[model samples]
Target: MSALAAGQRTLSGHLLAWALGALAALWLGFVVVGFRTGQHEADELTDGHLASVAALLLSEATNDFADPRRVIPTSDGDNLRAHDYQQSLSVVVWDAGGHLISRTGDAPLPPFAIAEGFATLELGTPAVPWRSFARWRAPAHDRRVMVLLSVAERDDLAWDIGTQVAEPGLWGLPVVALVLGLAIRRGLRPLDALSAEVLALDVQRAAPLQPRLRHQEFEAVVRAIDTLVARYHAALAREQQLASELAHELRTPLASLSLHARLLRGKTADEAERQQSLQRIEQDALRAGQLLGQLLTLARASRTELAEAAQPFDLAALARRVVAEYAQAALDARHELVVEAPPSWGLSGHPVLMELALRNLIDNALAHTPPGTSIAVQLDAGERWLQVCDDGALAAQKPAPAPAAQGAAARHALGLGLGHRVIDKVAAVHGGRFEQRPAPAGFSTCYRISLP
Candidate 1:
């Protein structure tokens, strides 16, 4: 994943986890509250029913007070009502002095202060949960009857109710978590689309970003990217402008230097002075031509729209043509130039640039080698090479070696008499390198341009 996408996914994962936890905590709290409320309502209803029963019994005991023997046996008759209630209740009756006069069941009633109204209390050996209410009755003038009713249910029932209340959250939590995860992923779709669009952009073409955001959230980010791209274009244009101006400014000084040297050559009348001036004029003209050519090449090479028209052409034909064209100059310098390109040799490139590059190589070879040396241009098909060799100074003075094994250094060194700027630029434009190697006969220079 890209850095942006990975970061978004991490954020979503953490958010989903936190949301699920928070929702689960809230669901648990609601379940707990519901369970407690349900238990309170159930206990209240049971306590109210038991309280009515206690009141009815107290009335019966008061009515039968005149005949103690007819009041029913301790085990049978009217006391049987107390026995029936004893199944779920423990009853205790007391006078105003806190003395217990009537009792039913085995569990002891906790100590209670005598009061005029009802009060609830919990009881048991293992501290059983119960609801107890005391009823205060003053039937006659100064006599009072107190009845306490306590109902006990098993602890297991309370737990069962609590578990029942938590059922919904247990079943629904995973579903909510899944939904949240999907929602987070869906919400980040715009960002993913935006990243893909950005990656598709090509700096050369410099097309504008698509205005295709799915939501308003990414408006600022998209705008910022667009602004940055505009700035880059502006910067690139400025650099190109500066390069053009610098190249233009150098041309005038070069022209003036070439003109002055040429003018001085004719004015010097002495044979020695005339010869020296003529040599200086030729050297300065060559240098001026070289600098202008390099500036032009550099300007055109970087243009994106600039493209070479490539075609298949006979390598030997092209090599022979350049050698034949420069042969007269070779003859004038007392040199023997030979073309050794075979008819079967072939290569392909932009014809015009290749011609320029081959001509520069020929010029450099002729300028450096001594008179009467034979220069041969050979097209080797087996090695896919066009080799130019010279039989002068090859085993003696060689040019600088190539920077790297793959990097071919142009051998344009001519003891400061010839300029290298033109040859280097031509090689660069043709995407080739120049190298001079030691030969048994003399020095040989090769201008190797890769064919596309």
Candidate 2:
């Protein structure tokens, strides 16, 4: 594939990657939050259970607290119950005087307060830590029968949570990314197919593109490609037609010139014969010049910058001057040339280009017609339009089409090869159009140069 094709493909890939990356970031954020939340929940459950156990021991010991000896054994039993029995917890008990009486295992006791009710405490230092909940029971009527129980455990709730909480997506992330990547590739398949279609196209076969873009997001690109294909096909057809017309137009004049030159070469040519041959040569040369000029005009009209330096000008005065210049030619052909434009008629465009387009039409009509034909120039002005038209007047009104007509017209339309290039370029730059139509009597061409 070409660089442009690769760039387009890469663009789609980039977009897919970006979208997926954003989703992944959001998912990861949720996962992090979920992990933290799970740890917090585990800590709460462990603390809550320990508190319940402490509360149970406190209730049991409260009955025996009147006598120190009786309460000591029960307190020891409570400590053992929390530690030796439960594999995950440690325990300690303190008397009403804040003296440590019993302990379960070698786990250090959390630095709990001697006050009544329950309290959570962190043991060790800030650097290394363990935590526990302590329950202190001292009924209002029995100040001497006070007891304290503490349930202690190592603080690794976060680690325990990691082990217990199941993440359904833990093993599914890679799989999901792979699936999404594949889906992205599949979704963009239509673009690849469209590229291949365009690459295979040529002037001879400018087939319209019909790619299956499953996603709505890609529809605009597909439509644009299709529209481009259609325009390309139309342009190719026009080019071919122009070529045919060029050949036809040049055939008769070229043949005549060649034959006359051959005749002069064959015999001992007299001065008169030589002069006749030379005159024919000159005539043919002039015809060739005329054809070349028309082709050039058409080329100019199709150029992208055909009217870059356009300026406002009085349409009426310009028309009068053009008509005056053609007055002598019209009279020679026994035709009348008249200009009918209002003094207020004004327009904006490249004056030279506009004059060229108008002159070509008049010259073409007069050249094909006989003497005594009437031609009138008229300008119609409106709020949005400035139109110029010519009345058909002349003999031989339906002369055979010129060989260069198609070349001229096609170039004129697209500003493609030569003359049309100039016209199209100027027309585009000026934001204008060139129109030609068969006149009621002969033919008329109009150049509607818009004004700001």
Candidate 3:
């Protein structure tokens, strides 16, 4: 699976898998330890029993028989058949000369090749495979006693002991799994509720998501989400306010254009009147166009659309170019335009945005400043700052005192107009601000955009 797909799986699945895997490992370890312990215990008990039987039979032979090579009769078949354990066991005795002294119950001939101790004999058959213990009664007697038991019987006992030891855990596994599954489901209910809240959120309406989560683990995530939602709501409100303002600002020029069009259509009895009407229409159209352009610039500045057009360029050169482009307009307004900067200073940013900000500043100065006003465009290389300072009539106008209960949009509108707002936004995008203060002559306003 892809890494992303693997990561996207539920946390509960991973948790449950790990939990079950650990439990399984523990369960396997219990089974192994139980089986080994039971097997070891069975071996000790079986070997001890064989040793005791060999000792007892040797004692009986030494006491009862006068000849060391005498045979013992096992003719009482009823007594032998009554003992269940004896059916699975065999005993044999031999003399030093390899003569079989005595034997019982279909005992196989013991291999004297093995030294006196416990040993396993294959016997070349599946059913009667043997486990045997042998001992010499004493060196002087020249007799060997051998005791044998079936391997299958010992294995059966060991398996039974192991099963008894492991039975409880084996039976409890399903109950444990069920309990764990229920615990996991209960533990994840908070996350499920949080997910539902998130899914139900309405971005257009700027709705907040509030989930009653009991987990402290989700606190940070919830706080971050709430913060983002608040920011989104603020941005939406600002855009709505801007739209209302745009419509209000455009109404006057549109009404003027409409009135002039009617006048032109009426053929009002005189050439000069018709010419005046056309000029008025043209002026209103220009005003409306300028307003729309300013609004578009503001929109672009507010969003990331202009950021994609960013590139490294010489800021001083761009400033000089903008100054030159507006020089003719300054001349027509009877204003002096001056640029003070180095020949070149490198900067990385959206050049179009910088140009737009510069043009707006210069145009504002040209339109609002009296004739003979001097507008200066200054570039400071060390500070990476650009400033346009204009001595203008509008610059002389003092800001009105803010009302105590003024809303944010009202305060913003009071502080800036369409062109000024666009310039301010452009400056903000470049990590700077616009500044306006009284100059020594009349008044001075500066647009400063910090460059990187």
Per-model TM-score on C-alpha atoms: 0.44, 0.60, 0.62
> In model 1, how large is the Cα lDDT of residue 209?
85
lDDT of candidates 1 onward, in order: 0.58, 0.56, 0.72
Tens-place lDDT per residue, model 3, 1-452, is: 68987669687887888888898889878877977787788778888988998888777645333343443334344565455333356778776766666665444566776688899887744446788988877646577778887788778776777777777777777788788978998898888888888778877766667656457998887888887788778766866888888888889889999988888889554899898888778777777787788778777766653337557899888888888887776666556899999989887777788888888777766665556567898888997777777765553353432353122212222222677777776776776676663443433665666655
**Descending-lDDT candidate ranking:** 3, 1, 2
- lDDT for residue 113 in candidate 1, whole number 0-100: 64
Q: Which is better, 1 or 2, measured by lDDT?
A: 1
Cα RMSDs, all models:
19.4, 8.9, 9.5
lDDT of 1 by residue, 103-202 (tens): 5544455565644445555566766545555665545422334333434442344445555766776777788878888998898777778888889977
Instruction: Report the Cα lDDT for residue 284, model 2.
Output: 72
The number of the candidate with the highest TM-score is: 3
- Clashing residue pairs in candidate 3 are none
The TM-score that candidate 3 achieves is 0.62
Kindly provide the TM-score of model 2 when superposed on the true structure, using C-alpha atoms. Answer: 0.60
Candidate 1 TM-score to native: 0.44
Cα displacement (Å) at residue 81, model 1? 18
Candidate 2 stretches with Cα past 4 Å from truth are 1-16, 61-130, 138-154, 163-168, 188-203, 206-230, 259-277, 296-359, 362-386, 390-452
- Per candidate, the number of residue pairs that clash is 4, 32, 0
